[model samples]
Target chain A: MNPFKTIFGTSAVAAAALVAFGLTAAAPSAQAAEKTSFKLAWSIYVGWMPWGWAADNGIVDKWADKYGIDIEVVQFNDYIESINQYTAGAFDGVTATQMDTLGIPSVGGVDSTALLIGDFSNGNDALILKDGDSVEDVLGRDVHLVELSVSHYLLARALATLGKSERDVTVVNTSDADMIAAYQTDDVTAVVTWNPLVAEILSMPNATKVFDSSDIPGEIIDLTVVNSETLADNPAFGKALAGTWYETMGIMMSDTEAGRAARAAMGKASGTDLAGYDMQIASTKMFFDPAEAAAFGASEDLKTTMESVRTFLFDHGLLGDGAPSADVVGIEFADGTVMGDESNVNLRFTTRYMDMAADGAL
Target chain B: MTRLVNRHPDRPTRLLLAMLPFALLIAAYAIGSDMRLAENPNDKLLPSFTALGDAITRMAFTPDKRTGDYLLWVDTVASLTRIAGGVAIATVFGLLVGVSVGLLPYARATLGGFLSAVAMIPPLAILPILFILFGLGELSKFVLVFAGIGPFIARDIAMRVAELPTEQIVKAQTLGASTWQICTRVVLPQMWPRLMDSVRLSLGAAWLFLIAAEAVASQDGLGYRIFLVRRYLAMDVILPYVAWITLLAFSFDWLLRVLQARLFPWFAPEGASR
Candidate 1:
């Protein structure tokens, strides 16, 4: 017998045994059978603090037990990459902006549905310019941003507001994390990005917010988008996951000591303290109450937002040639039935779960 | 003398013929770009040619400074700088390790075997550990490139050293030559050709490592550019960078060959077969 092969075989067996032992040791609690696990992907941001909070506290597990399913949340540092990975089938669900849901997964032909309306950028996402320049001054100047992202959409909206076309300025495709560094280097004259990068860049001497997501209001909404197949085959999993989100939100908005502790834990997990986390949550305009989300779900606002996003995605070359209108992106109920007219384009929301939760039916 | 150097009268014609396909491809692409056949609207071809013609014209005349959409040139230069830096470090470290291990048998027995084992380990497997140790900077990239090329060069040179003709060493010893004299005068002279060969081979490996290292936790460089383009689904930017990287790699390989031919002319005789 070859000595090298013998040693290699022994090491492989040892490694396998160690991995098996670790997995068995970490096997979920006795109530694991009552719950089915669902994976959630999120980008690192202050607006996403509730996700960490839910996982750190027993809120996710409690909600799963209530709905008879398991929930697991994974975080990604890059928002676009997380969406892309979700589209590529790495995760069951991902947090994404409305524009990305239309442009990325919907365009890529992956059937996806918005499981939860997370938040909309209020003042968190912005276009910062050097001091002494108005929004009008930005016209015909190069604008740097993560092209085809929510920030890019904000820039386009800003340009339109100034009676300018996209061609009026050069749009450099710079990432949100690198926008601050690029601004510091004097390589770009203007940058559009989201916080905490926006916050960091605003600290520079000449930097000031010339435009922000508030201009577009609900157009830049964020959602927890789930794979259509996962929702269809595992409706219980989807309900459990949504329940976990509501539970986490309850803790976040509560004024109790445990709630504060939960917020602190979430802050630490997300690399921020309680006050800093609160500032981020406020800037994001998050919906912290399940009742509020249920009310929002029944409104015409979300429909209008999805319609505008679908058209924007088409113009940005994200949608495929002669593709079906955005209505087919799977906004269906737990019973796997379509919600409304295919031509409505704006009605990309399923209010069934939210209505049930609000009425104490779940 | 001109006639003697030009013995292969058809060399120029052959070189032109070899470049014809590339030239035609560039022309076709340029014309396609001018005609708006190149999917991207930001296409920049010459003013006279349609979109396709402009693409051909732009392809012929390399863009230096930023023009219409010529910021790609800056990206290309940045990528080339990273590749050059990585290759330079790899060559220096590889040569040092290769020469030291080749000269010392006990060193070869320990360090050479260890390096060979390390060379077999995939770079991706070690990237996370390196990230923790080096903190995602140029130092991490340099370390990965050094590790990747050093072991290969060391082991190759060790094998070459073991294969050195015993007769040469014996002859040197019979002449009352000291160990240092044998190494400097006899061994090094004979080793130069093989060392140069090792460098040529290691350069390709080093270039690969440079790109791979740049792919992880890098804000700038060719690999980062490739990664960012993929995220936005911008295949147009991806293609041009791919072309630039291919051309750069080809140029480096040619440069190394020219250097080898010039520095070690004795390896090929004057009257050798044409």
Candidate 2:
């Protein structure tokens, strides 16, 4: 064969192959219809473990299949990072606390809705005093806790119980990883922290649980928050999530062998044994019954709880720099009462899916 | 010295060359940030200059509403104090150990291999153990930076000692110099410059360990501030903090270079160039 002919033919073949490869690579987006698949991010917490358990136990799959959609469950080692991922649109939804959802996503400009009220911290978070029987003993001492966290909120509320404020004691910003270590130090006599850490610290002989989240119930609420635009586009996603959550809740609430097994699995996943997990669960007021959760969501008490949370967040400057007041991010409740700026509603608490779960409509 | 592309630029040209990359980086970031903001004004990953400027003013200039601390200055002072204290301890101990390891056969036999092994252990991996052992005070953070950086400095000094010409030691000995005389006059004098060079090389790692320790368990630090704001996707604050850290690191490296040049004008380590 002539050299020119062979060279030209080979080059032409290579170009065609490249074009074909390009077309194959570009085909997926060209045929992209409405997204049927979604990702849900969850982190390790006593309140959020059900989302993981549901995914692992095929509960997530069953519901997703029923709705003719695919749901992928992702676990983040960090609680805040999970919400950040959801805010960044890397995930469609996430397990988050009410204040966190409002402070981060709502104020940061991601319109989100609390899809399910997973649980509220009952005694999961606590303020403990070393060698002191009363919360008053923490007076004039530097209180160690993760600053601007729910522990800080608990401390503020705990202090309020004593008819005092943060001014009574200096709040030293210790990290969660170092909380136990800080407590072990002689100088560190008081600390405000959450469960697992609470469990560990309370195990020490002199440590007394002076106050906890239970003292202010429904204030530290955990929720499965979903992107509002995504939910509006795919109501099936909402139904599927509600189904998955309530189903998991039923089994988890039961004292049957299977329920115990699921609980044990969840405990193991969260780096604890059965008894250890149960202790944490004892501190968490899990909304096992959808009707109760829905009623709580619709109640006027929720608006009051949110008001306290928003005020706490705003006072701490956890809200974005642009926030002129606590009302920078609007939080609409099930009764249509907005807690913040009504013109810019971002975090909405709707009981629709919870109601459907209660009525067995999903 | 034997490599390809050996053409050297003058000092002003070198300075201009160094500035080019930074200028290009800033331009590229501005463009990307503008494009993202044009699409969505609420985008956080690359915030606009105005947002960053506002964040800087709030963090650096204004007193915090609750605490009344200038956030940036406090964080910087905290971080710098820890790093300076840690590195200072590292330097003194490093000089003593490195000289011994380099000059004494016993020190070489005892500590040379052990130090090499210690340096091999990843500092960040044992951070929890450090916190637990040191009890989460400033001591733990200091010890972490020391543990991370100490062994490497010692090893470098030891090697520099070994590299000392035998003739110089013998010459001093021939002149009836004592064992201490060779170390004080010949060995240590040479090692001082090398010690500075070794420290210059390790400052990057020193910063890494310092930042990691701070990130893990600090009340206030540059790294702590960066990590704390990360939860909110506060890129405006985070980016400025990062740039400030970079500036601090570069200043330290530059200061060491100036110090070395001023103190040892007659000396130049191998591979020293523009």
Candidate 3:
């Protein structure tokens, strides 16, 4: 026997594969029946904080119980990995950005529904140069960023405004965890990243924020997207999650001490102090009111955002294997209008749940 | 009722036994993959071997759109070069310190404990410090691999030399051999094969540090590729890269074993006595 295999008993390799496969074999038909329990995955971000806080504070439980279902909110360390896990069917729902919602999961062929638009990154994502007076100084230089992330998207947009393409500069793929330390080096003069790393980097001497996501508002949006199949089978899961979210959103956006405490707890949970978390929250254009979220969900602006996102993702080759055109994946908006290839609609932006919340129907 | 058999297994039997575990592992993986794909055809984790094979062909055969370079081959060459450079530097430095410490009692007394202490200091713990001092360029990764195995090599050599028969030294001295002559002629020759063996043992550790350093920060390497695709749950790409690393490590070990056997005909491999 191989000593490594003997020692580890396959180390959950065989078991994990079997379990995942077994679940998949039964998932489609099994999900058609009622599901009493479901898992939702979230990551550490200012806009996504309410999910964790709501889960911890029993707010998710309260809302879930109201619908006679159990909702478990799980946290992921890496943002993109959480969406990947959702795409893998490990989670029923996940928190994602507009780009990732269209790019990673949709491109991966997992049908998803945008249940909630929590916030838009106004000045949240930025480009910082150590010594450059303008973003154009990045020409012929290597810009460090987490490649394929919103940071990469922001960098591409920033370069476009200057009439420069990705060919103008080299992209050095760096992790968000190491970006700050990398920026301190003389070798790395320019970096494109998102908060709270963006906030921390800009605090450094001579670090200039030459570009931000605020330039194109409503383009970089954070969303709560659930598996369309799961939502179709268990509508209560959507109602439960939306109800819990807006309830927590109300507390988070309020000026009362209860609200402040909730925000502080969320900040601590995300490994940042209240002040730091508050700074990130400020840069986030949060849609606290369900009426506003419902309106945003049903707006023409979302279609435009999706169009731009598809173009950016397609141009970057992030739209998956052999993606012949930008219309490879169809996006169904809230008003039943489908954009792109209608037969292959993978992304659905539903306003019914949000409109219900706005009407206090939940 | 039973036929008489040879006490030792023949070459075919030995080879069969050697391959059985790997064959079983492959079977287990295939069955697991089949089950997963049956459930969800788009399952990324625990990808079928066919998926892995497809990913390998894509990465190795096709050029990336942006760079127009075959990334797998580029990554392999980059990783191999870094490890080779780091290991070569380590071998020279390790041999010099190990031999000096072993030959001279004063040198051993002063530096022996210090080298032991250095070996105990986990190289990974000081990775951030190395990055801070050396910058995030190739130097940091090189230093990581060098620091990871150099001390262990030195300590092992020191121990091997200390355990050598004292009579050899006395015989050389009785022949009116100078201290330098005794050290250079008697010690260095015998220590060479052992050094090669030590290097074979350190290759595993050297790869560990190299990959960790690369995974944390690098433009191009096998570790970088694995981590970069990890966000997408591209296990098809990752598992193949892991196998490739294992193959490389195994090949290096086999080469060293052959070199040791060819150069030192009298050296007994472990379990040969039984």
Candidate 4:
């Protein structure tokens, strides 16, 4: 009848059951078994259009079916909140920028892998200034953005280009949706942000594009990140997802009527029409071809990019305590090949699935 | 000398007294800024003076474009209405429960203790459960504030009733008065002043809970506006609304005090005279 005794008795029975069953309770029996169900979270953004396309066209389900699993996609109005939910174990996967993937999951001790590289910002992200003001004019002026985010990184890079340290300018933390309104109030002199906010701000009479992501292309990569344990237990899940993504990309990029129709549907789901969506895509510098992504996966450039990103994140006090080596960002393909720092081992990405897609056996 | 001190000042003396501090401070500031008021008066003093003047102008005159006047008036009315609703509910429940428990010793021991225990639990701790049942709406906010103050008021009234002088009730009974008449005429009137005290205490408690409730989920109230401004880091908007809320709290307290004095003049005649 003692309270402590009752509590311990109940917990002991539960722990015994758990220990008897072992951890991988619901894993599939064979390679061709029915696919597991999953939910993915993402915020509204042009770069994230492909996720909607995959969902509407049955590409995500088809890939899941091929992999023997079911998948559900959920949308959030706030990107950081979506990432937060993912970190809190609310979703199996999340579509977020690379910086968020590192900051939210990698830092929060959730071993996550980048399953797919959606796109990198080209001209979509920018630092806008009033007319007649050069980048030098922005020196010592406050630059507003969502601090500790990709926009902040872009601002730092832009400032570095002008031979000015980040110390030269004050950075104000402002949400993307409110950044335009803040700029309108003249509370701050400059804003570093992404579209459609960037597009809206540029339409203002005195607003001018002082610099954009074009100068530092491929730095702001959008990715589909998944938990490490999920991938480890079900390797085929990764392969199936990548295989379906490549197939969907082929449909989207083809010159066929079906491809155009798919793209238009994708645009609609993303809150933009086809032409507007295309403009966003053009600025995003997306890798439409699977072969190119696979080649990029094999190249040394990704390693260099990740190394620099990790170092920059650490230097800016964005990374958590006890600096993680650059190697933690590395991706090891299923085959013998590896990219990025070897010592920096966190579940970042496994090129194994990309290799399978490249070989046409997925 | 005392009569002279109270005498009305002539125009020159009044002007001199008014202008003395102003002239001295300006002279000191001008000297501190290393500018001669005679020669470079227009340029040197203009910017600093304009900044101060602009601030004063803003405070005295609410801009039509900002819509501050409409917002200020609406927020004031909304907060007052919420407090009134809470107080009205608390008064009815507090009086009924208090009188019942106070009259019965058995009820005092069981129900009075339970109500006091309930009052000890903070309302915020139960907000999520309330939200789940009542939903994220005005009803939830009302329930939260009601729950916060209702039990305290009830228990206080109950305790006050139990401790009331029994001699008066016995005297009324000896005069051949009916139980109902004795209760209504003697007991109720005597409890009024104490009930007002309970109400005054409950109003402050209710306002605290009301602001907390509004801060979480309600859409248009002052707390919600403050939270929205906080999300955008709009310090200007936040500061003005904060000032409005402070003014509102002060005004409501004053209104309650005035209502008490006007309705129950005998409660504090000496205090009012001073």
| Candidates' C-alpha lDDT | 0.65, 0.84, 0.85, 0.67
Tens digits of per-residue lDDT for model 3, A250-270: 998899999889989989988
Poorest 10 consecutive residues by lDDT, candidate 1 chain A: A26-35
Candidate 4 Cα RMSD (Å): 22.2
- Which residues of candidate 2, in runs, are more than 4 Å off? A1-33, B1-20, B269-274
Residue A228 of model 4, lDDT score: 71
Question: What DockQ, on C-alphas, does every prediction get?
Answer: 0.04, 0.23, 0.38, 0.02
Ranking by lDDT: 3, 2, 4, 1
lDDT of 1 by residue, B185-249 (tens): 87777767677678778777777887777654454576666775466544444565677778777
What is the descending TM-score order? 3, 2, 1, 4
- The number of clashing residue pairs in model 4 is 9
Residue A177 in model 1: lDDT: 44
Evaluate residue A94 in candidate 3 and report its C-alpha lDDT on the 0 to 100 scale. Answer: 93
Task: List the pairs of residues colliding in candidate 3.
Answer: A21-B36, A24-B39, A25-B39, A122-A214
- What digit string (tens of lDDT, one per residue) describes model 3 on residues B50-142? 778888888899898778999899999999999998899889888889988988999999999999999999987766577678888888888
Candidate with the larger TM-score of 1 and 2: 2
Q: What is the TM-score of chain B alone in each candidate?
A: 0.73, 0.93, 0.94, 0.70
Question: Of the pair 2 and 4, which is ahead by lDDT?
Answer: 2
